[model samples]
Target chain A: MKDVYKSSMLYDFYGELLTEHQKEIYEDFILNDYSLGEIAQERGISRQGVHDMVKRCDRILNGYEEKLHLVERFSKTKEDVRRICQLADSDINQKNISEIKMIAQEILDNY
Target chain B: MKDVYKSSMLYDFYGELLTEHQKEIYEDFILNDYSLGEIAQERGISRQGVHDMVKRCDRILNGYEEKLHLVERFSKTKEDVRRICQLADSDINQKNISEIKMIAQEILDNY
Candidate 1:
């Protein structure tokens, strides 16, 4: 589930690289959750065409992911941030909030 | 900037949607840091072709970003994770570690 979210976010970030046909099909199939048949009907293409396009697009998305590992990096960064936030919110720690703030600042600085 | 990182991650995630030509240009321009002229020379295309392709790809990437805001969400999640980790690390906080764990679990649950 998280992977899907991460992938979607990645998709949002790089979707413009797609051709028009690829974008239309992806928007319908992935983003809109339209079925193959539904997308085929909407686009006036065969269900096979829709399926092939979706699969091709998926391969392209996954290819970039495999090579770059951007989502994984983002996920790690997110985990780091979450840990710091929890520290800040904890009542047991007062001084730690400053530390957490520093960490957050560091992340932001690198960001 | 974090935005650039986020965008890069997103690009990595969704880059497969691009056509082969688009991917080649993108890999060169964005990932490989080749200038438009360099990319054009390498691809044996005009500099204008390289420039136009890069701009078009940027638009497509930004378009998905505008609609989905995946990188933004990922960034927020990362911040939350960092906070939680800081809480766990603090010596002043003993019980807060458990709270931090809970938050991490919650994020994971939803993740």
Candidate 2:
């Protein structure tokens, strides 16, 4: 289940690299919570075939993550942005906000 | 010279995925400006072999960029960050600074 969430996030970052067919299968499986049997029926393939495709999609996404780390950095950036917001609400210096924003902008712009 | 710089920058982002042999040959040729003959002699390969490896490395790096757009985003983020810095320098709402910082942090964190 947790893997599903991770895979979904990884998909968001690297989904463009996958085939359209793989994208549909992965979306239905991970995001829509469809069973492999259901996905197989929908795609007109064997259940085992569906399983294999989903696993292959996972490997492709994971491989990209291992090398590029777009998903990992994206999660960290979210946390850092949250912290910056919290700090902003407090008595932190406004000038610090400027510097922090530059760093944050750089990260958001890329991923 | 332009191609060399671009390759060097691409290498900064995706060089790790290359084999050690590719890495050494690429660095010597691109980064160190070694002549093909020099690198060929150094690596005990023919000049043609060195030429082929460098072209292969370019294709490999270019392929990753086309799929991922990491390098493209990275270049844009730098530009955006510069803009954020400029905005910070100019007179602006302090609270807006906070909100903008959050976005910037998110971008920077990922790429």
Candidate 3:
């Protein structure tokens, strides 16, 4: 379940960068939860072929994440925004306001 | 100048998805401001080839932005963060604090 979640998130972030065929097969295997044999029969390819393509697509998506870290940065920014919301909810004071400003600036700086 | 800025931002966000050769040529043309003829001479390719590559890179980057809107989202989130900072800098009140929370939630929601 965790692997599925991570694959979906990675696909959400980088699937567009994949080739058309890769996208179709990967969407089936990962997003649609199609079995390898199912995808193979549907695409008129061997199960091994489907498996290799899925692996290649996973590698490609992971490579993009490794290089760009878009997903990582996004997760960090979301956490920071949550922190800001928490600070805002706590107390309306000078220190909390300053902390909010600091966090907001960090988000702007692509934290 | 404006085009350069936009190009750099797009490239910064999506360039890692491009091939290494495309990255090199694109960095030269868009980021380094290298002329097509110069790039062609340096790369031992025709000026037309260099032009086409740069244009293709632009299209690819723009397509990613069009599909994913990462760069657009980043800009919007940055603006929201700036607003949060401004609100924090101004008078501290219940209304302003709530506004900050709203904006922070907006950021968290991937605005």
For the predicted complex of model 1, DockQ is: 0.14
Structural similarity to truth (TM-score) of each candidate: 0.48, 0.75, 0.77
Per-candidate DockQ vs. reference: 0.14, 0.25, 0.62
Error of 3 at A9 (Å): 1.7
**Fnat of each candidate:** 0.15, 0.20, 0.87
Question: Which ranges in model 1 have alpha carbons more than 4 Å from their true place?
Answer: A1-6, A98-111, B1-111
lDDT of 1 by residue, B1-111 (tens): 124454466676556556788888887877777788888888899999888887787777776567656567666656765665465456555576566656656655554
lDDT by residue (tens digit), candidate 2, A17-100? 899999999999999999999988987899999999999999988987898676675576556655555544555466666656
Name the weakest run of 10 consecutive residues (lDDT summed) in model 2 chain B. Answer: B102-111
User: Which 10 successive residues of model 1 chain A have the least lDDT summed?
Assistant: A1-10
Local accuracy of candidate 2 as per-residue lDDT tens digits, B10-88: 8877787799999999999999999999999988999999999999999998887887776776676556555555655
From the highest lDDT down, the ranking of the candidates is 3, 2, 1
Which ten residues in a row are the worst by lDDT in model 3 chain B?
Answer: B102-111
- What overall lDDT, based on C-alpha atoms, would model 2 receive against the true structure? 0.75
Q: For residue B21, what is the lDDT in candidate 3?
A: 98
Candidate 1 per-residue lDDT, tens place, A1-111, comes to 224565576576556567888988887877877888999998799999998998888777776667656566666655765665465456655566566656655655554
Interface RMSD (Å), every candidate: 7.0, 5.0, 1.9
On TM-score, the stronger of 2 and 3 is 3
Instruction: State the DockQ, from 0 to 1, for candidate 3.
Output: 0.62
